[model samples]
Target: MFKKVPILIFFFLIFFVSFEDLYSKDEYFLTLRNEKVNLRQGPSFDYPVKILYKKKFLPVLIQDSSDNFRKIRDHENNSGWVHISQLSKKKAAIVIEEELILFGKSTIFSNPVALLKQGRLVKINKCKIEWCKVKTGKYKGWVSKNGLWGLL
Candidate 1:
């Protein structure tokens, strides 16, 4: 019986490592599931004025639970809840290069931003909108919607 002690310990260790994967936060890659999503100010359709999150867009901030609402923070640090049905899970390319630009500051408007690195993730903010916003290095800002991705 003593000879089996080490084997049992090895199996126990393996189980412990894999256990974390079960409880880890569920992550989903955004996909353009809907034709359009409105970025409302409140959780329900009754909310007040706020910018619109148009169609076929990918947002940097992702949500998986259909809680009917999502708490979000704007670049100005404003916080509020919005309707989850008004959003989609579409993924896009984000520039990860060390050097990048703030879309508003650039003039080209077409290909104003460049020097993007590989493997960076960007949620197309709004394709129809004039400016597109992206999330990189934990920071969110606007980019031209026509360039590559749309506003989510």
Candidate 2:
């Protein structure tokens, strides 16, 4: 009976901790699933649309969540509410500089693959300390972490 009581207590503690973590209001990264998503001034559709995001896979920082909407900040530092269904868990990033050189390798001295324009949305494959591997269409390369948004 004593051993069983200790095991039950351990299981309860683990469950409670996991549940709290699931509901915590922590900031997270999300990508736009659709090519065209509307950012509104408020959580509901009744609010006026403030911005139109035309690029799919654009990463946004989720600041808060309402019943069916999420308050998000884009790479351009614009804050608006978007429908939750428009967001996806798939990782992605947006180029923040006027232009960025994608390197075949992680370093600048390495071969340049392409010149990516600002606001280009790319799927994030992985990230290191100073660079992240991204892909858009047929191009896949690494961009400096300094010029990207949504690397956390």
Candidate 3:
């Protein structure tokens, strides 16, 4: 029994550190900590354009980096970079706070432009700067990243 105790403690320590990283998914999975935040035009300290963001509304968490700007996507599927000051610790998933939003593109491997005639439900894969890589079931492509909700 004494010999097994050391082994068990080693396993426990390893699990504690790596286990938390397993669910490091980014989305607006967190809610805003404060009532409101300023939506800036760019992701740096210099760019300070005041865009309107709702109070307590969650914004998508795209990526965590060394810069103060945290990339996020909006409800329209439009992706952009926001200041880190706009974020909150409260984590959550998106819920339909408004009406049903239609997708503009369809799934066609050869005819991407033609397929995007109507809207559809998309599963987001990830994001880059201002573009969100998403899959509308059959079609995997890029969208503006503003179509989906932040954390609900």
* Predictions in order: lDDT: 0.50, 0.91, 0.51
Q: Candidate 1 residues 1-152, lDDT tens each?
A: 98899999999988987786654444333433455555556667688747644434443343333358665543223345556655555556444344455454324454444444433446644444455566655556665444442223
TM-scores for the candidates: 0.35, 0.77, 0.39
What candidate 1 gets wrong by more than 4 Å, as runs, is: 1-36, 62-67, 74-79, 96-114, 117-152
Could you give candidate 2's per-residue lDDT for residues 1-152 as a string of tens digits?
Answer: 89899999999999999988877668899999999999999999999999999988888999998999999999878999999999999998878899999999999899999999987878888899999998987899898988988868
> Which prediction has more favorable lDDT, 1 or 3?
3
* Model 2 clashing-pair count: 0
Candidate 3 on 1-152: residue-level lDDT in tens? 99999999999988976776654453334444456665555777576655555645454556544377766665456455666666666433342323323233432222342133323334556665644555544656655444445423
Clashes of each: 13, 0, 23
Model 3 weakest lDDT span, ten residues long: 106-115
1 or 2: which has the higher lDDT?
Answer: 2
- At residue 22, candidate 2 shows an lDDT of 79
**Model 3 accuracy (lDDT, Cα):** 0.51
The full ranking of all candidates by lDDT, starting with the best, is 2, 3, 1
